[model samples]
Target: MFKFQLNAITAVKALVWTAVRRMEVKDVPTPTPQPGWVLMRVRYVGVCGSDVGGFLGKNELRRPPLIMGHEFTGVVEEVGPGVSKDLIGRLFAVNPIIGCGHCRYCRSGLKNLCLMRKIIGIDYPGAYAEYVAVPADNLYPVSDPVRGALAEPLATSMRAVRLSGAGLGDSVLVIGAGPVGALAVKLLSIGGVKDVTVIDINRNRLEWAGRWGASSTLSVTGDEALKSLRETHPEGFDAVIDAVGSEDTRGLAINAVRRGGRVIFVGLHDNEVTIPGNLIVRSEIEIKGSFSYTDEDFLKAVRVLESGLLDPREGWVDIRPLERGQETFEELAGTETKYVKVMFNPGG
Candidate 1:
């Protein structure tokens, strides 16, 4: 078999932006796969909020000079010895974090929380490059149901839904109707939740939420949402999901749920935040944090994607090439369209 090599692994990098503060883009090297790894040509990659944070310098110092993109899909062009022959030419989804299974986190079946986990696009090189090297184990061959590029985010949203503890007929509330939140809404609905209300300040985002299966979309402040909570369900919701990490949203979640309702926080803000713990103390609310996804969740995410349920075209995504990723992410913060997901198409 051919050991694939790219002519160049140019990447779109994020540099500081002062004016609109929408960062500039830089191109860097492709990469070479070493032993126990597979070489891929990125096909489709999702530009997630974390990627935006890096560009906006929210996650700046944590990792600058980093190739931005984690939720991605690609084709294996070459595989080193010890990798399965079935991988080459196969469409595959990459698991950014290939955990060290012996660690306590992994041992607890929580590989996503592994302290030494190798996070692609974070700790190591990622898909924004023309060529990316991933451990053989991180590659899952794509089938008809799920496309390779979309698997990562789907897995992420799936994990959030799974950890949410929201059951069927549960009234759910998702704040910040961003891309991930919208995806969560879809997952919650599919998981048998009877109602899922999404709140966002952006009118377009609120409208976009409807496509993601939001039972209702509201453009209300946290204080107002609380007031409505009284008339709607005084006890609060069965599950309240904070998709964006904002103190206001977090507080609303605390004050808006029933005493025993579950709250799942998935969004990531650069800084630390404080919440109403006293409310939690009195209500005995169940608060859980969700990050990334599990293998089982990944498989299920693939099933959902393969089921033809989510068509990004039908939804609100604008796909660009890898070269435009930085601009696209930065532009997203200012877009007037009803956009939720912005993707990159790294070509052959």
Candidate 2:
């Protein structure tokens, strides 16, 4: 038999997405764990690039009056019926994607590709609140709260790199030096890819990419950026990953990769893009779209975080109280700032 918390709390603070480009902290009723679920006390929740797009009304899938946050870490506060009591008080990184068990994709362990999958932040209530209910099976034990929050994004990078088929000594070009792109560079470096180049209009991001593992960093944009890329590597790269997902970056990825090279699209900034189909066909460039990570990728990310191979908090990530949600979103949506990643502490 399982024991439940007798004195369950009721209200908690949360950052509520009220409308386009608007979010406010409000008092919300604390979530109660349902069967096979556990309530987690949120510690840190990272603001993903997709969250920024949602804030600007760019992502059509995100609806208003919702709690938007998927990248998070917290402690299991209470468990519902049939859940292990030992999970209580333990820190955990959540996979966030819950799929229908019978689907072929879910059966194959590719829950991210399941058509019936329901994501935490989008389909259901998310971790932007002080407490969130998650499936017990989705929990992965973690030590550090802040670093654990990074497991989701790192999983994304891992999947992109894996799909690219980049290996030892492969020359790869990553477009965009944002958090995902920079993480990709670090992963490639650890995987033995020595010649990795990162290009972004943000000098600060590019500089941090250099420190993270990029063998070369270019702070350029537009046609000039393409010109520089061609001049720098006339032979083209073995694999080019477009982490920006803009039309320009998409075009650049195809043009910068060698004939028969791989182009991995991991960014979702633009839903529709015009690409040169002839060039892709003629060059025989392999293009693949990488979405969210699988369960295995999420676990590998947690292990990587546990191994201390990367320091996500060093000079790039900013932590703020939930009260700053509006301002932070405004800042990130307006001008490009030096801050690469912004996380909210709901407890504050």
Candidate 3:
């Protein structure tokens, strides 16, 4: 039998940190299924904001010379021993977290907090290539191949909203209208939080959030936005979600949240943030830090996607060929485009 050779977009390290000369396409051998692993012929792989951060060397968790992609979907080409062969040719979306099942967090149903978790792409080879080998347990069969890979990000958004403590009829404010933030707004609306307000620096994104079920949108280009927010919502919102993870957005979440209300921080763009200690103490605010999705969130994400209730159509996603990964990454990281999400089609 002839061995399969495939093309992959890899992040190569450069001497200069501020250059886009890091990523390039290279031909590599197709990965094979290992024991308890399965081989997936990658179909669609979405480029996440974390991937942009990783490319820009902002995320220390992922080093260069890596194949960076985790939010992806593909067809099972081969299965290892102990795995049923009946899954061959099934389309599946991958859960990138490789958690040690016996860990305390994993055993407690908080697998995203597992101490020994190894993320695909960050810790292992990912789906930026034509083929990838994943643990069979991490794969979920998907029905819609076009948007099926969205389960990963949708799961993250779902986890954030679940942590926000927002329920039916609650007035929620989302600071950021990016992919995760937009998804959070849509999910919050579905969860029965009818009064949703989205804030973003980009008017295009604010409009996008409006279409994504946000009851209203706010354009926060500068300091004046805070004044406008206070004038409009003098009492603040029942719940606030910070999906921008910046000093400004973090402060906005703190200031825009009602006293004794909850605030969930989900964005990973910034690692460190300085907040007013006295304000938090005096107001008795409930601040929760949400990371990756738990196993339950991932399963629920799959069911939600299968339901077709939260449709992300329109200009939300831009599909490109795998070969154009470098330019697409640069485009998304550069000026604000109408495409909130970029998905790479490996087989295209």
Clashes of each: 4, 0, 0
Question: Candidate 3 — which pairs collide?
Answer: none
User: What TM-score number comes out for model 2?
Assistant: 0.95
**TM-score, cand. 1:** 0.88
Candidate 3 lDDT over 180-276, as tens digits, reads 9989998987778888988886777778788778998887544677777778788888899988777778888888888898999988777777887
lDDT of each: 0.73, 0.88, 0.80
Specify the highest-TM-score model's number: 2
Query: How well does candidate 3 match the true structure in TM-score terms?
Result: 0.91
Per residue, candidate 2 scores C-alpha lDDT tens digits across 1-348 of: 122232469678889999998899988777778899999999999998888888888887789988989999999989989999999999999999999988999999999999988989888888888888899999999999999999999999999999999998789999988778989998998889999999987887888888878988887777787788788788789999999888888998999999999999998888888999999999999999999899999999999999998776677889999999999999877547787788999887
Off by over 4 Å in 3: 1-21
Better of 1 and 2 by lDDT: 2
Q: What is the lDDT of residue 279 in candidate 1?
A: 84
| Model 2 clashing residue pairs (backbone) | none
User: Candidate 1 lDDT, tens digit per residue, 157-197?
Assistant: 77878777888778888887777888888888777786888
RMSD of 3: 4.0
Per-residue lDDT value at 136 in model 2: 96
lDDT, residue 168, model 2: 88
* Candidate 1 deviant stretches above 4 angstroms: 1-25, 144-146, 335-337
Compared with the true structure, the alpha-carbon lDDT of candidate 3 equals 0.80
